[model samples]
Target: MSSSKTIVLRSSDGETFVVDEVVAVESQTIKHMIEDGCADTSIPLPNVTSKILSKVIEYCKKHVETPNSDERSLKRILNPLILTL
Candidate 1:
């Protein structure tokens, strides 16, 4: 697929999320739906608000940009500091 492919997600608070298809798939539910051919259009997330979804998208983007770097994982981040102490 082209790198430019994106999927639109609609939040419960009437917010629209137009994000990379990869980023959107971070949500397991969405991923399954996509795999099952249920994501034909804007995926409606009636349970998650825009603010929360925005954060989720941010997290997704970060992980996508650095799949190997565990900077975002709490366990990875805390382990280093804990070891020092």
Candidate 2:
């Protein structure tokens, strides 16, 4: 399963990430390239640090599977509505 649609992304710190095409498509740039059939090779994300990129991937993975109900609920629950005079 990993071999068919996976692309290797090399970070500035020399860390490598194996990402699926579906996951990588969250990026608008990658999504366009994929739609145009130009993502046959590995995509390099030089500007993003490995740690940050990993976190982004994690968020995308979670959101892709489930809606962000907790975040929405938190905003609704925690934000105070104030009346101004």
Candidate 3:
């Protein structure tokens, strides 16, 4: 569904991640920025490390694919993410 739409995320470590526009806008902050027409170009996340950003993206992808996922299951899945951070 996200054929030609994409957004670039520049991580604090100077790593750039080109993600689907729909996926990138999962963050409420990004959604608001998009709604306000303030995020036309690459979005900079100066505080998030590349490792954390990657994990967050992975999590968002999983969540998006399973919108009605059980909370307990999510917690189990997320425990590793939490432990890593």
Candidate 4:
């Protein structure tokens, strides 16, 4: 594997997260922004709370790391966070 580029994400609570571009693109919205060259600066997610955004990043990171992971596996990983949120 090669070193991947990264993107900066800002949550509604003003928290900033730096995530790999692959992980960041897990969101179609972010993917489009990246494609449109709107990600040169940090992408703002004003609708997402920091806690939820963090959980989302964790999910995306896992998905990127293990692309073959089954839906059940991903769901199991995300269920706890969903219930808490």
What lDDT score is found at residue 79 in candidate 4? 86
Give all candidates' CA lDDT scores: 0.77, 0.63, 0.80, 0.86
Candidate 4 local lDDT, 1-85, one digit each (tens) = 2347889999999999988888888889989989988887899889998998998998787778788888888788778878887
| Candidate 2 lDDT tens digits, 16-77 | 78787667776787678677876566566678778767766665555455555587854443
Pitting candidate 1 against candidate 4, the one with the higher TM-score is 4
Query: How far is 9's C-alpha from truth in model 2 (Å)?
Result: 2.0
TM, every model: 0.76, 0.62, 0.82, 0.86
Residue range with the least summed lDDT across 10 consecutive positions in model 4: 1-10
Top candidate by lDDT: 4
Among these predictions, the greatest TM-score belongs to 4
Q: 48 in model 4: Cα distance from truth in Å? A: 1.2
Pairs clashing within candidate 1: none
**Model 4 clashing residue pairs (backbone):** none
lDDT tens digits, residue span 28-79, model 1: 9888877888778888889998877877777677667767775458456445
lDDT of 4 at 17: 98
Error of model 4, residue 6, in angstroms: 1.1
Model 4 stretches with alpha carbons more than 4 Å out: none
